[model samples]
Target: MYDHTKQYRCTIIRGKSKKEMDDFLPVYAKVIDEICPCSESEFESLFNNAFIRFLPESDRIKKTMDNHRTEIAGKLFGMYYRADDGIVYESERTQKFLEDNDQPAFFKDICYKMQFPNGTQKVGTTVRQRVADGICIRPIAFVLKVLLIAKQANVFITKREIGYYILNSLDVLQGNASPYEVFEQIVKDQKDGTERTIIVPGKATSYNWQHIKEQLNYLELANLIRFTDDKRVVLNLNELQTIELFAADYDKKPEFDVYSYDLSSLDGRKVFQLDWDYYFSQISAVSDQFATSAEALLFDGTVKDEQKSEGKPKPAVNLTAFGDEGESIVYEYEKKRVSEFNTRLANKVLSLGRTKGIGYDIQSVIAEPGDMAEFVKYIEVKSTKRLTCPDMNDDLWVDTLNVTRNEWIAAQQHGKFYSIFRVYFTRDGIFMFVIANVAEKLNDGRMTAVPMTYRVDFNKSSVDSVIVPQS
Candidate 1:
């Protein structure tokens, strides 16, 4: 419900405004004066260096500045003239100058502004000011606040715990109503399009807890946090401080204090119970979206298997009857399917099961029409039995399906040419899902890559198939 587009517009306008320059220039000048008195050109050089250091390494600030020098100069002049002369600003002259010359630096747009219910706007002094003031609607900042709370508590927290904490404390932190009272007002504003007011004690609308849980997933994808073996959310201590600083939009050390909590005394179960039924009801509304057998297998409680309870008898064919041999059936099926898809390249499809070091289970070729060329494709097939119950020991439900180090390395090396075939055996039939270029997805955080195996030191040649220690 947060208006991100409006927030972005506010940021850009604030960054490009005269007020921002006026606020920044004096502080910059004082810093330079403390070091050594310098000419305007020297001051500009020093300030530019200092500013660039605060920005992400990937930014194109220098190139943008060089390409738009004339427009930037004109805009600066217009701002300064209007402020010093105490006259109404003339936009036509500046617009004409900007149109005739190159545009201002692209980096100038990164700022923040806040709009109140009244027809008034508050401009941010810096690009990060909006984020620091908690006016920005970015999930990263909210997630960082969760981590900060966890850090202060010195304990790993769960997603449910974080959501409850935010629901209870965010309004209080912002100097609004108490946690119980705030959502009622928020819901009223959302429903009637009228400004919210103090409400008489009555039934309140339910809050969306899943939205907060999804934010935790975003943080995990960013590598700022990791799920422990016990499924608790653990902050990556090494990245925590750096992430906090970046989230706060701090150019150097933060000027403001981050919120902390005494979570040790807080009962997460009690807090979570207040809206548990409502949260599950919200989840149930979206249950139909996950129709795949794999999703059903992963979350047995929420995602019901379509094959079952439809009066369809279970298939007599047991996919996992022969263990690794059953997976061979899937590999054969994949090869046949690929061959059928491209009859011309069928002869080029080679089963790599006998080859141990190749990593992939199959290698196939796709014929390119109008050219005497063939594209090589590597496929890794993984077959699993129908999971009727959830695995209690695994942090992630999908961890039951394991990939060796060699297979992962091969996927990384082949990238686009590589694919993972996950075959799920259901009561109806074997359902196959293709994850093409899985390595690329994993690297980009689109897919999660959780480590599963641990190595033990051993001399392979020194031991026989069955090792018997001397008694």
Candidate 2:
């Protein structure tokens, strides 16, 4: 119960009766239109005006210079908007998702850190100090654990229960300790000759209950939990199935990053970049954290591919059945993604895997909302089959990838239109990491490319004529 590993806590920005997490998209869309085409340095000043302009006149006066106002902007923008090529814009189609399903966006993005642009220098203080000082906590983790805790009693949990048990007390959040074992452990509260004493949940001292109520309001707005008739919290029955998906992973830790987070802060554009990348890394874990219910991820036609051998003990993959199932999976996923824009474009998506020299494996299109119909996309698929599914924390689980000289050249040629869709074959499902504009990462000195193998050709005729022999 006293383990330091499980003692994580959250520090959500608080304001009275602020239920505005759902307003993220409309504000972002409006802010991007007002401030984009401006340099990355000009973002904050411009964002200040746009953000202030969006708030009600009465609220605007109080928040024009408020840090809470900017903090909320960081969280909202970090989740959905980003700065690319010196422009701030919305990356996720959360507005569309809500329009299609009548619900809020996913909660994972806001719960974790974000990635930066192709090139960013100094770090910023907004998100870094929060982590180093032990101020950062994933809100989703609390939502799940509190619901799980409440399941023990088949009743709603009040603010004091959460404040006493989870928010303040720490048995380290991950364990299977029975109710009796947990409450029984003590720190010798009264010892003339005593071994241990009880720590009552009722005598719970909740210092941060007011702040917790603020977060609960946001989580509730995200459709994460339900408020009972008396305004207490409980887990929705369907959320239990979603909770099952997280049986393996619930906490979004900040352990994995190829870059050095030892610095005090992060770059401005890089802040949004990191936020976007963090969100991308999460899609592989749960089918869809943004789903209205738990069953949104579908396995329509894809099946787990297994290797078969004919009484042999030499190799692992059955050579007779050696095939590009991963590529097939990627091709289908890309097609489905494009179909959201237009069926005609999705039908036009082609598998160019058979043609080796082209570098890219598939051809597709990318479309921004309220923009042009579509732009041709060049996609290179790099795939690996993991024998055991690896953890996708803040770090890149599938870190290194093999890129042919030809593929690198293709990435250089197509630039923004090019993407490397990293496809991972696991027993659970096919997971992917969409890396766009590889050339920019190379040019900006953000990503490195190392030469591993060399190719050479020889001609006998040329050797005899052009070469001189030494005795």
Candidate 3:
């Protein structure tokens, strides 16, 4: 999705304020559901009137009964599945947004393509036009990743540094290219060879260094970042406590090397459906970790979350972080449970996630209060971050889980001693469900397993090697 050789510029889509969007998008979707196959003008009229009803009794609103169809679609066109015949339809993302009704999910979709090389807005085009392209590189994700990395290294980064070099180049944004290293090169181009405001123009790299910063200003709604007195960009840890959520250790690996696809020919909804399902799967508000509070999301310049999730605060995150966190959460849970019975067994609770070929993540033992330990149990942790907490709400929910070939084999070999701890991350907290004796369950028709992925091999021995004279 990222071209290392190409340079990309940031695009801004400030078609509406945060609250306007929070109010309008859902209403737009509702109108569509209420009347499908509606004309563009019809949608515009209904959506405008419906949304206007939600506003307060203000003179400004009363004075100007605006037609915001163009403005609304400018920023959020990617969420629409419209027809060339001027009709609109319900999209998968629209359904997901309605399914998980909130400002965070709404803004989450927005942020996924808020930055450069985005689909919702044009990139490197004459018309850096809002709602023009069909590509979503998520430079914000890359930018966030860079900031998180620099934070760990105690590196103070300025907005210009991020905008000029990092966001401008796909190499730094999507490849292993370092922002500091690229900045160092930029310094070489400078007459001062360091930070300065010396005038230098006519060169391709010397003008408009703060282009992306304009778009960065729009991220105030998310409220995930702050600027220092020196204009350095920093995570808003002091106010939001979002530092832990963006921890560098959470997702240690980089996602630079991913399969590439072009959807410029497709519509916004189709592009979003594919990207939402695959590209931004774990990175968006769909994951509890990535989700911000309602206040941060729907920021009117000031607000914080009133209702925080209870229990150990394990925020849903990327897949790697999700697994690591799930294992740790289960490990702690096991330790605490065992400590109630036998402190010694609790101390012995082991995290085997790093241990190779274990086919499991954690290890514990079944025991009674009086050190009545029965046998050791191998735990395989399967984790997923969802829109809702089935445990918290007592709602019956089940998702198809992919079990590795090694894990299935371990479940079979370990018999009754094996347990699968299913951990689900919601905005509330992580909920775990234990399924013990998986082999027996599968044998007795209680459960079934299917092959998800496999490695294919040819029987070379059967097809004997040709022994021909050397050419």
Candidate 4:
């Protein structure tokens, strides 16, 4: 009798007659049913109820059982099988497929390329490659496919609720105890650990559960860590965190805040710049001269006398002090006004340069000194005396320096992301700089003045890196 206890190499028997291979269907059926479940008892019960092994004797009897096994595995586990005389086959799950020696050479090559470069190119490319190489029938469009699978956690719920479950579960899973114990501990920890009764730890790194639940639920479903009783709930802690190998020490590490924001508020969504395109479009439609020439830039002076005298249409620009000024003085004012408008638009353009990658947060920015976190340049306009830069600790001073060398080095080693520029802006064509590099002077009440019309220049020693666009 064949020693069936030994691991099947799946090669020598590849050429066996259909009747010979059909004899092993019972063994394959038993193992598949067993390993599929989390506990042995559950698998045993499921296996016995679902299948009946036939005595291997006549080829007719063997072929009949082989077809039944294929159909059963397919329906139960999304498996498929093909037969050559009496032999049966089915596609294995990814984890099982890796260890299977009998896997087709084509599948083996696909696995090699999928895990190529040791997973560096794994992100955003796996599913596409699988399809392009004909490994899978269709392409997986996003990087989230792997994250979904790893979560072994299937089932979908609202992003907000799912987020709550993952987070609440994560809280419970920490500390020295079984995950079951972690749940009760979290409820206790939340009530007492913080000064506040409701311990709402700041924000997550990228998502807000309320806003992104559908996408998140998709992830939970593919991983198979989903709860059966509460189908909407997430149950797998190890899968949720995407940690393949769990170490007790890893659970002890410090957690960082995730970036999240509510942009619905007026203050949060305020457009700092008015639409100049609309204004120009209106001007262009008025006349050919205005459209083609600089005539559109002219300010209406005729309305000042009639409009000011008759209180009908208000003069285009208000003047607190314009007593009997000559054409030269008026020309200068008009030019200055246009320049000011352009400068304001330029400042707004600079503000858009800030995003999550650059680590600009509305909460932190609103907390910065002097309401000037976005102020890259500052100008002190004095009518009579020349504007002098204040002392290092002066109230009106702004720092336009980057993070200091020592602080930057420390941040590079220990920080999750660099704090490159917490402050930089321009006001009235004067530049103010409070960069992350000036960590020493950040808290100090120091001020400096510099030119506003400056641009970054690159030399051999001072080269600027390429900027990547966010999708």
Candidate 5:
């Protein structure tokens, strides 16, 4: 019994001498290597036995072994394990199973950490147990499942389709741009005294206004609006207060970017670059510290890629049919700088893009005409090159533009609309461009688009501006 106890304790020596442990160290090192592949230093230290006394495994050690086994399994499968819950959490959509159709405290914390663009509050408790287990499947599998369910629920409608549906229902509405643009114009017109209106529901405005009245009633119950005793409508203070309160709520609806448009080829899948989700997970683990200091989280920086060439020119003899081909192409690539600020902005935008209610997928990064959109002072990121810049365009570059554009556009349309900045990097390696005067100079184009021009100044460390550029 004593011998068994010692073995369980992980003690190598039993009724033996130092020579036995020395001999056993090599074999023990190999076993440890198999169990904990990631922490090589720890494994080696434990295996080397160059120091430290021998001891047997205690109950704690046994439990640790079990944990190691689970971690290994999860890592191999690219899944998350909640040891406390004894379940694996994979992609954001998979979380519904654990939510129990209602938000649970632990799951709510995780939801905020994920910053799900839709901001699902809790896991659905009714999720199939098998799915909650670590199941090997593609990320889109969850989308297909949700879409199938949404089809039945009649909520599969895209935002784009909603505009026409609503327009048809309106008595008199004029919006020629995109659906989102139309929605913006409607809201704008209502606010700026260009138009006074109430949104009513029905296939046609002439039909019975019952649905519209019902919607108003719903809004009344939510305290977002008040209807006259006769059933007409106007915004209520309580509704505005509730909007402000829930706006502060740490949750929203959930959505995903299927990237269905970019799947033109098999290799494109490898280059499709939307792995910021994983990076968001990393940032969320440390969100509390950054949230306390919002300014510290602001990113106003740059990244540069340097190229190095090797060797002098080799003899290049190549003719139509006569001789040796050109010398072998030789060059190397390196990342010049990665600032913490750049990372913070990228992570914040990424987290914002993942949010539920304000989920927006960025489409492209362009230079801002000015730091104002719709008369609101907005954050903007500028690029050194415009879409028409010939020399600056390249498919092989590892710049931020390619990685973030689509996601940003998506976020703006769906979730937290993000802003971008583009500036020409000066020869002195500083970002010194400004966009103040130009925004105010342009009037009609703010809501639509504008021509972008960036000046190069190597002297400035940061930008300061007061003028509100339109468009």
Candidate 6:
């Protein structure tokens, strides 16, 4: 797991130790000798091609090279050719990859630190502090690009097709050359000035298709697109309109650059940077929180019949005056019962049943794993007397349930800390069903959302329902 708290402490140093240099320099020299075998004076050109070819065609590598191309290119130039300049560079993405892959650590234990002729210390260059700072590709930006591509083609695109389109387009914009042509140039540029030519080991590819599929799934989670059963995707027209408006406002900003590559270029207009923060803010406002599953309320036994004692006289009450009051009492009773259940688990529960506009019905704090900290849990309790009875003939039979807009919105905001508690009043006892992080489950397609009220739609999907049985 990526520790957000410890990210700042873990950094790369500029210079390499003697042992590191000894180990890495030979590998670098071997690659260069095979590729270019240039004289020491032309080592810079030889080293650049070697280093560029060394990068794997992975998503992380693509992101790193995209953001730090100049820095990376400069470091190679100084490392092999201009020894007087020294070499020091650090980036979080690269450092993390090296650590994970057990590659040589960067910016640690320097054997010798270089100094400039002016007596200035030549420390290593730290790329932008946060990954977000150097982020050129964002999920929303990809979403916009995918939508534009679909619009241009006037057809639904498969995830694979979208991946190919993005990969090809990115190669042109970033590399300023075709994939194969770039690969050929790298090999050709590294000629040894002899009859012999270096043989490139692998085929050149722009991007990995799997990574693009993952990106598509993220867009689906953000509700930017919808997927068909056949894995084809259609742009969410509503989301596209909102994004277009966002693009329009972004274009009016003073900081907007016309020369940048952006999705706006699809319409032959001047490009402008998309406002990531603003786009997310809009998504947050409309997205709803999670809801409970219908299967959680299922019970085995049939509804119990009310039996009257023999020869016992029944007292009748006025249905007109006390009817509303009686219903209110039942409603409060169910809420109190659910609250007590949560309280028994050692969680501090606060009832917001009477508190208007709070969205959730209860607020509680529960200890996280390893007892590191406490997290506030927002719960929207839904009570019903109905039970999901299984039909012997049809396997698809299920109980239908409704979740209001306010409740759903709360789930979206709280995310992991949000849950839906279904308290079912049965003839024998009350049954409790807990569905945590309902919005995330919905986003993952474990649950589906419909208009008016969020529906579990058990008939359409399998439910991983967990029930807390009455003791």
By lDDT, who's the top model here?
A: 3
Q: TM-score per candidate, in order? A: 0.28, 0.43, 0.42, 0.16, 0.16, 0.26
Candidate achieving higher lDDT, 2 or 4:
2
lDDT of 3 by residue, 1-471 (tens): 323335555444445544344335555555445554577667656555654644445622622334344334323434455555556555555555444443344444455434333333332242223224322344555566666566545555677666655666646544446544654454454535455332235645424444465445434334556556667776543223443433332223323212233334346435444443233322344334444432232222211221121223233233334467678889988899888877776767889998877688888888653443846888998765433344323221223355777788899999998999977554345578889999999999767565534597878776767788998
lDDT of 5 by residue, 1-471 (tens): 001011000000011112221222222222332233234234333323421222233422534343332222122111232322222233232232112111111122222332211111112221112123311111111222222233333332222222222322221111112333334443444457553332335545423333233222222222222323432223322122222332233122222332231334445432222232232222134222111111111111111110111222122121121100100000000011112223322222211222333322222221224442222222233332111112234221112222234433432443222333233222223232323322232333322222223466754456565588899
Backbone collision tally, model 3? 1
Q: Whole-model lDDT, candidate 1?
A: 0.39
- The per-residue C-alpha lDDT of model 1 at residue 440 equals 82
Question: Which prediction has more favorable lDDT, 1 or 3?
Answer: 3
Off by over 4 Å in 5: 1-242, 245-263, 267-471
Best by TM-score: 2
Q: Give the TM-score of candidate 5.
A: 0.16
lDDT of 6 by residue, 1-471 (tens): 211111111112222322223233323423332433245454444445545543445523544433222232223212122222232222222322222211111111010111011011121122122121222222234335444444543434445444444322333222123323422332343353222221224622322233344344434422334555665565444233333432232112122122232332333221111221112112122111111112211212111210111332122222222222223443455446545555454435566666767777777665444452345677776554322212235322222245667777888988988887655432234555677899898899766655532356565257577689999
- Candidate 1: residue 422 Cα off by (Å): 0.2
**Steric overlap count per candidate:** 2, 13, 1, 46, 63, 7
Lowest lDDT sum, 10 consecutive residues, model 3, at 300-309
lDDT of 1 by residue, 1-471 (tens): 222112111211112223233223222322222322334345345545644432346653876433222123222222111122222222232222222210111111111001111011121233224334453233334445545554454434455444544322333223332322433333444466653222224524222433344444334422345555555565444333334543453112222121121112335322322222122112122221211222122222111221122333232222123234434665676567666767666777777766787778878764445453377878887764332222235332231245778888899999888888766543234566678998888889767654534787789786779967999
lDDT value, residue 457 of candidate 2: 82
Instruction: State residue 174's C-alpha deviation in candidate 6, in Å.
Output: 4.0
lDDT of 6: 0.36
Which regions of candidate 4 fall more than 4 Å away from where they truly are? 1-67, 74-223, 228-230, 240-471
lDDT on C-alpha atoms for all candidate structures: 0.39, 0.47, 0.52, 0.26, 0.25, 0.36
| 4 against 6, candidate with superior TM-score | 6
> Could you give candidate 2's per-residue lDDT for residues 67-143 as a string of tens digits?
43344444433323444465544334433332222222344333322221111112354345433444323335544
